[model samples]
Target: MEKEFYIDLIYKSFSGDLSEEEQNQLENWLSESEANKKEADVLEKTWQLSANFSKDFEINLDAEFAQLQDRIDLDEKGNVQEAIVKTMPTIRKKSWWKPLSVAAAVLLLAAAVFIFNQNPATAEMLAMETLEGEMKEVALADGSKVWLNENSKLTYPDAMNGEERRVTLTGEAFFDITKNPSKPFIIDTRDAEVKVLGTSFEVRAIDDEIRTEVVVKTGRVSLGKKNDLKPIELTANQKGIYNSKTGKKLNYEVKNLNSISWQNNMLEFNDLPLEKVLEDVENHFGIKVILENQDLLKCKYGSLFPDAKEAEVLKGISSVFKMKLVESGERTYRLKGGDCQNTSE
Candidate 1:
C-alpha cells in the first residue's frame, strides 16, 4: 500500500472513523508480522509525540515535504516519475512561509522531546495504578482528585501546561475534578469520553462496554461520545449512563445520594439487584462470590453495611436474604442454594 494511504488509515483509526471491516484490516496489518508491528509502533509513537508536544513552535511544511520527497526518491530506486506523481498533492500546496514555519516548529518540538526524555521517573509517575483489593487515590497537579478502582490504570501528564487537561484510563475510576473554565478536563477511555469543567463522577469501561456514570456531586459535567461529538450536559443532581458500543445513553435524576459512600468505607444499596450487589462486593473486596441459585441472583435488595470484614458483610447479606453462606476458600465465597421465606422489610 502507498504511504499516504497508510497515513490516512492511521488518521482515520485515531479519529474512530474506520468501519468494522476496515478496523479489522488495520489491526491485521498492524499485527500481521514482526515488520508490520514495528512499523505500526513507530507510527503510533510518532503520532503520540506530535499530539502531546508543546505547540509553541511554528512549522514549515514545504521544507519537510521537500525532505520527504528526497527520501522517497532515493528509496524508490530511480522511480522518480512515480514518486513525483505520488507527491503531487503535497507539492501543489506550496507557500513561502511553510519552510520557515516548519523550522520553528521543529525547534520547539525538539525542546519538548528533550524534556520528555530527560525524566524517566516523572514519566512513570504520570501513569495511574489500581492495587488489588484497594482503591488508589491520585491528587493531580491541578488539585483534582481521582480514585481508581481495583485493577484499573490511568495515564496523565505530570502537569498540565496548555489549553486542555487530558487523561486516558482503562477499567473504572471516580473523579472529583477541579474547576477550570478555561481548560476543559477530558477523560479518554476505550468506550467513551467524559468531559467536565468541575464535577464528581464515576466512569467504568470494561469488556467492550463503556459506562460513564456521572452524578454531579458538586458542579456540572458533560458526557459525550469519545472522538465523535459533544455530549449531553449534566448539571448537579443529574446522572447519565452511556453505553458506547450501542451508542445508547440513559439519563436520570441522581438518586440515593449515598451512592459514593463506598469510597468512604460504607456499602449502601437501595433497590439494587443481587447480581449488581455481588459485582460491587467482589470489586470492592477483591474476592469471588458465586451464587449457586440463579433465581436468587435476580432478587433485589436494599441495605446498608459498614465496610467491615468480608466475612461480616457476607454474614449480613445472608441474614437479609435468609440464605446460608459457605466459605469455599481464601478468595471464594458461595451463597448456598436456598429460597427466602419472608422478605426483609
Candidate 2:
C-alpha cells in the first residue's frame, strides 16, 4: 500500500472511525511487514502524544457522531437553517472520499484540542525542551533518560524503535543512554552530531561562536561535525571540543570523570582571568559586573561562590583582591581599586 494510505488509516484507527474492513487491512499490513509496523508505531505514538489519548486505547465513534448531530441541530435551528438543509443534500451526495475527509477533519480538530489542553509537565515528558538557564531531568518513552542543561532543547519522537534511535538537540544536554547495541542513539545538533550505543556524556552546542564540546563521563561516544559522516570517538574521561567554524577538534587533557558540576553552583577555573570569570558569573547568576581599571581585566583569580547570591560573590571577590565592590542595583555592580595586580602571583 502507498504510504499516504497507511498514514490516513492510522489516523482513522486512532480516531475510532475506521471501518471493520479497514481495521483488518491495517492489522494485516502491519503484521506482514517491519517497515509498515515501524510506520504504524510512529504514527500511533504521534497520535497519542498529539491528542493525549488514553492508554486504554478505546475510541468512541458514537460520541463523535453525537457531536455531529448536535452541530446539525444547532445549524438547522439557527437563522441559517434553510440554507444548511439545502446544502445537506450536497453533503449527503458527496463521494466516499468526502465522508472520510470530513471525519478526518473532525478527528484532527479533536486531537488538536486534546493536545492543546495537555499539562506542560506531561508535554515535557512526551517531548523534552529547555529554555536558557533551565535544566531538567526527563525519562524518555524508552527506559533511557537525559539531563538537559541551560539554554538547551531536545525533541524526540514519542517512541523509539528500529535500528537507530534519533533525537534533535539545540544548546546543551547530558545523556545517560541505556545500552542498546542494536539501536545506536543519535543526537542531531544541526552543525554537529553525537552518536553512541550506550554512554554518559555531555554535549554543549551553544551559539555558533563557541565550539561544540562533548565530554564523556563513561563508556564511549562518537562526535563529528554534521557534514562529516566519520566521527571522532572519545573514551571515558576524555573531552573533545569541536570548533564549528574551523572544524578543528581540540582534545582536552582529561583529569577526572565526574558528573558535570554546574548543578552544585560551583565553577572550577584554572588560571582563568577575573574578567572572564565575571562573565560566567553574570550569565549563570544573572548579574552585571564592571571593572574600573582596564588592567584588572587581565588579572587571574579563582574562587567558589554559591550560585544563589550575586552580592556575596562580589563580596568574596572584593575581599580576595582588596578591591571595593559596590552594588548599583539588583542588576548592576562595580569594582574599583582591587589590589588585583598586587594579589596576583
Which prediction has the highest lDDT against the true structure? 1
Candidate 1 lDDT by residue in tens digits, 58-167: 76664455445434434553454465478768644634213222110000000000012122333433787787767899888789888887777767777776577777
- Clash pairs, model 1 backbone: 58-101, 58-105, 59-101, 59-102, 60-98, 60-101, 60-102
TM-score of each: 0.48, 0.49
- RMSD in Å for model 1: 25.4
| Reference-based lDDT, residue 131, model 2 | 75
Q: Candidate 1 versus the native: TM-score?
A: 0.48
Estimate, for each residue in 182-262, the C-alpha lDDT of model 2 and write its tens digit.
877777665566777344555555543334556654456677776476667665445655554446654433332222545
lDDT of 2 at 293: 65
> What value of lDDT does candidate 2 attain over all alpha carbons?
0.59
